[model samples]
Target: MSENIGDLFQEVMAIKQAGEFELISALIPYAGLVGLELIKENAGLITILRNKPSNIGNTTIPAVHGGVVGALLEHAGIMHIICECDTTRFPKIINISIDYLRPCLGTMDTYARGYVIKQGKRVTNVRIEAWQSDPSRPVAAAHAHFLMG
Candidate 1:
């Protein structure tokens, strides 16, 4: 039998584990908000967040807000939990940490990529990176740690 994507997170618990914005729009509102009317339902997070123009996102002076950038990172990582998880249940966010490297420049779009470094029975570890101009010159990167029910 083929593996149903929904079955991946069948045992997830915690309100935060409900990662998909479309699943509970009222509850999540903007699970992956990008400011410029972002789409929160796309399953291809790696490409979805690959590169977003700074124009679409909020900008502060010459750079974007630190919080907004961090959201982008968290959003990218959490998307994986939602897309791969089964509707049988929801997954939750336990703890996450992000590090800023470069300035999110204005007028330029940015890109982000997320990968699952590890997925344990009770927790998941993900790594994400956001870059502008050059992928090698990343603007921000993060390592996410999530908890499951």
Candidate 2:
């Protein structure tokens, strides 16, 4: 699996350099498993998406699973680090703290963006927000630490 991830990273970097845009999401296995898509916007911002039905955690309120949300946020942070740094090896997640602000309605797609708060030689801190429909109203947010070294 680790080898596969490395191979995926190589493919991702290749497409990224080619500016293919849409295919970058295939680099992360978890993203593909959960239907996460990568959207490249202007001003160097990256948005991650999780499409509907497959991500529902609760059918009653139709909320996305907390684990899925966390994974999505973590993936964003990982990507942010990858883009900001020079390494192809996957960053190791040191810790992540998530805040669930509202129910992630399973009917709509979920989106997230990660911000690198502090970056060091061996570690980095990132903040992430997940939303549906409106960026101002995030369904969940997270603070994460990663060991890039």
Candidate 3:
């Protein structure tokens, strides 16, 4: 997988056109493990969904794990950068900071969007927001920076 970023990018494009969001997990295995799916793509915006029982960390509150939320945001951000730049090299995450605003209901499917705020020759910054039911009431938000070459 590390040696085939270009191939993966091409596959992603085909899947996007076909509206086969489920196949994204197979093309990007980490996404498969995390139950991440590309739901929509148009222009420069992309939406991601994650639904898996293993993602829930607090059974009492039925809340998604903090780590899982973080992974979803980071994964979305990386995919956005890849699709935007169409680069052969996989972007390396430099740093990220996530803010958990509310409890994400475990029984619901969570959706996220990663917006590319700025892109330079070697670095890209992205803003991510996630919600379960209402986009206006996001459960978490994050900012990520990636080193692209």
Most TM-score-accurate candidate: 2
What digit string (tens of lDDT, one per residue) describes model 2 on residues 1-149?
53544566677667767766567676556668888777667754465665667778898998888899888888888877766667656779999999999998878788888888998888889998989989999999999999877
After TM-score superposition, the amount by which residue 19's alpha carbon in candidate 1 deviates from its true location, in angstroms, is: 16
Q: Decide which is better by lDDT, 2 or 3.
A: 3
Compared with the true structure, the alpha-carbon lDDT of candidate 2 equals: 0.79
Clashing residue pairs in candidate 3 are: none
lDDT tens digits, residue span 29-88, model 1: 354344322234354444233234543345444676677778777776776565554323
Off by over 4 Å in 1: 1-28, 31-33, 36-44, 47-61, 84-88
User: In terms of lDDT, which candidate is stronger, 1 or 2?
Assistant: 2
Evaluated at residue 65, the lDDT of candidate 1 is 68
In candidate 3, clashing pairs total: 0
Error of 3 at 35 (Å): 1.2
Q: Quote the lDDT for 8 in model 2.
A: 64
Among all candidates shown, the one with the greatest lDDT:
3
- Candidate 3's residue-wise lDDT over 1-149, tens digit each? 45846766567678656767556667766777767876555554445556678889999989989999898888888877766665657789999999999998888888888888998888899999989889899999999999988
